[model samples]
Target: MKWVTYEAGAGERTGILDGETVRGLAPGTTLAGLLAAGALVEAGDDARRAPTEVLGTDDVRLLAPLPRPVSIRDGLCFLDHLRGCHRALGRDESLHPAWSENPGFYFANADAIVGPYDDVPVAPGSTMFDLELEVAAVVGTGGRDLDPRRAEEHIVGYTFYNDWTARDHQLRDMAQGIGMGKSKDSAITLGPALVTVDELEPFRRDGRLAFEVSASVGDRELTRGSLATMDWTFGELLAYVSRGADLTPGAVVGSGTVPGGCLLEHVDTPDLAAFTGWLQPGDVVSLRGEGLGETRQTVRPARPVIPLRDGA
Candidate 1:
């Protein structure tokens, strides 16, 4: 079953997307609340019945499945991506042992989220703007020290994720042991629809998922890669993140950037060097994966952030 959220007169409201129509669900009940109640199955079952109201997809402006996630964790799980990046850069030993030994990830601001059809507000002073094509899983319930074997049970659904990056700030800040949250938080996208595991299980192998992810700018398809190429499975990623913390309901996790999914990984490639510069104002970007669907947005800078105090 596929779930969605969209703009309503009262504000964002939860609903189910069946074919060309969106059926509104219970009042004041957000998708997050359904997951927390461990009622996703029941909720979806009820939604299939005649809903409160039904509207065509074009009649409503779609928002992220969860407009504001409780937390966001993105991971680097693909090995081919790392190897390709190293080869392109003429470097050796780029594949560190720890990558295979343990899963690694970084925290992103949940508030960075924007709707699927909304314009992306680029962070100011971000010259190396890039987009990472990926898919994300939303947690259904809280779990601490989650067993990798059982992590799948906690996942509520999956959605397409566009992890917008300000590469300049990312590189500079991490060079000094700091995070680039200031830049990363400026742009992020999720949605189209949240497909439950049952609806997407056909794409799974063992515990890993395989999806053809593709991204395009305007009409040109610049990125294409397989999601199954990852070295770490989503189950492993969840277990690692839950080591000393909880994977709470409403929490979200990303599959990291897929191979060739972003410009940074192609930095030394001839094609990347010949590209028409970084993302500019008003460029339309589209990202799509197998069951996760697609999210397209036009680029725009978030209103200028002016500091009240002068720096030395």
Candidate 2:
């Protein structure tokens, strides 16, 4: 069943879409809630209760389907793209060899997420910006030291994510061997909707998922690839990531950017001109997969204004 966190008239709440009409669920609602309340079965029992009712595809304000992810872990799993980048930049791919042992990932601030339709703010004093199209999995059960073989059991579902990067800040941080610069204010965009594991399991085998991913900026198609192209499986990532840390329900784990996934792969100039030039204000980015629905967000300049001084 498809689930979503939405804001209609009242504040943000969870709901199941029935055609063009959305039936509200409780706040802090979860997949377990739907299963416990028998809502999932009810929705499935009748063909009419499908989530297509509350809003048409165009009308829904799709928030990140999982509102309160406990933690967000993102991994670098694209070998072909990584090798291409190393070759293009004339860097040593051997230094960052494909995971011979296990998966590796970094933590992302879950609260930093924004909705699909929200305007991404291009922060002031920023000239270099880039976008990354990625696939993210939501965790359902909490576990520790999880075996790679049982990793799939912890996943709740999957969603689309755009990991926006501030190149200037990122470079500065990278020079220092850190990632803080690439991971700051409004740096992540998620949602459109969340498709449950039950709805998407047919596309997976053992613990690896296979799905086609494609992205477009305005009228130009930028990237197209498949999840099968990934070097490490989600199970490997889960097992590696959860080694000592707790993997909680609602945690999000993203598969790093795909090949030609960002302008960085296609552009050759030193200033990254061709890359940042296309994402002018008002440009719309759309991402889609076979079972997971499409997510679109428009780029807009950060609003200009300053706060008044407290005793002025």
Candidate 3:
């Protein structure tokens, strides 16, 4: 089942993607609301009645499947990405083996999420803006101290996530013992549709992520890795997250950068500034995965504001 939130003649409403049209589920209801009400499974199955007016897929604008999540935490689930990034930055010391013992993640701004068609706005003075190819599970059932064995039950569906990054800000923040919050602000994008967890059973592969993740900037392919490479399973991550907090409906847990997904893994900062493949205005980034669908965003650089200072 594919669920979406879209804007139509009536207004922004929740719907099911059926063929080339979006069939409305109910007015003023969103995917998040449906999840909270525990009506998603039932709502999607029974949304066949005619809408006030059916919107052709082209006539409507798709929003993030869950427009407003309670929280967003993107995790570094693939070792190849970590190694590649560190190596690109001239690091030789290997990460401690203990670092991979448990699933790890960084909390992101939930309010920063945009939809598939929205423009990705680059932060001003960002020397390197990159995209992190990811797939995220949307929470359906809320729980505390969730068992790893039962974590699957809490997942409602999956969506493609583009974790946009401002590399200049990220590295600077890290140098001062501050977090990377500024570098990751106001740019995460997701959507097109949300595919239910049941729809992905064939690709489960004994419960570890196994979907192929792909990304491209215009005509150039940047990544061709698979979720099969994840060092940690969603169950383990969820269990770890739930240890001290409650997992709630509408929360998003993201798989971090797949191998070779971002510029940070391919080029050093000085070299990247001169690289044409690094995202610039009008560059379209297309991200896709097996069964998870695709999301494309056109990059738009922040308008430059020349700094003014009084003559010394």
Candidate 4:
């Protein structure tokens, strides 16, 4: 089932996407609301039988499948992403011992999520704005201290995610040995639709999602890789995140940037260095997955920053 949240005339509405048409759910029914009620699948079944309204996909505006997520935790599961980044920065490329022990992740700003087609603003004072292409899973059934073996059951669906970043801010913050709060809190793009786990059965390999994902800036493609390269699976990521904390319905977990899925990885690569650079105003970034759909956004100018320190 392909679940979607969209705007058409009245207000935000939930529905199921069947090819090019959208079959509406009960009035005012949202993906978040359905997940909280633990009736996401049931509602999809009901909509399939008797829809509130049927409209063409082009007739409405597609919003994030789970707009107001309870929380956002993006994982760093791909070994190549880490290696390539280190190689680019002229740093040691040796694997981190802790990375193999567990799937590492960090929390993101849940309130800053934007839709697939929304415009993303550049961070103020940022000259190295970037995009990280990934796939995100939305939790349907809440749980705590979940076993990695059974964690897959809690996933409701998957969607495309763009972890927009301000490289300059990220580097500065990282130097301080703290979280990447200002660097990534500006915006997160999600959407097109949330495809249920059952719908991606054919693409599953060893219980992990195996599909090609790519990113493009306008007409030129920058990065392309498969999701199968991750060292840890979503189940493992969920298990680690739920270790003493609650994994509630509507929480979003991301499969960190795929190998070569971000401009940062290509910054020092000879072949891509000439064509790729920090995102500029008017640059359109498009992230696409085999089954997860596309999330495209236009880069907008950054808002002026308020002065934190006085004096000349």
The candidate that achieves the highest TM-score relative to the unseen native structure: 4
Q: Between the candidate structures 3 and 4, which one is better when assessed by lDDT?
A: 4
Looking at model 3, report the run of 10 residues with the lowest lDDT sum.
Answer: 268-277
Write the number of the candidate with greater TM-score, choosing between 2 and 3. Answer: 3
- Candidate 4: residue 85 lDDT (0-100): 79
Provide TM-scores for the models: 0.92, 0.84, 0.93, 0.95
1-312 per-residue lDDT for model 4 (tens digits): 999999999799999999899999877898898889988878988889999999999999999988899899999988889888787776788986999999999999998989999999899878789999889988989999999999999998899989999887987899999888789999998898999989988999988788999999989898898888888999999999999999999899999989888887876663433444889999999998888888888999999988788851
- For model 4, the stretches where C-alpha displacement exceeds 4 angstroms are 269-276
Off by over 4 Å in 3: 49-52, 268-276, 305-312
Give the C-alpha lDDT of model 3: 0.82
lDDT of 1 by residue, 105-161 (tens): 889888888888889867776777888887888888789998989887888788988
List, residue by residue over 215-294, the lDDT tens digit for candidate 2: 88888888998888888877778888898988877678988888878756666654444454536678888887888777
* Native-referenced Cα lDDT, model 2: 0.70
Residue 29 lDDT (model 1): 77
Off by over 4 Å in 1: 83-93, 269-276, 305-312
RMSD of each: 2.3, 4.3, 2.3, 2.1
Worst 10 residues of 1 by lDDT: 268-277
Cα lDDT tens digits, model 3, 142-246, are 998989898878998889988999887888878988666678985888887888988888887766757787898888888898787788778777888888899
Clashes (N, CA, C under 3 Å) per candidate: 0, 12, 0, 0
- Colliding residue pairs in candidate 3: none
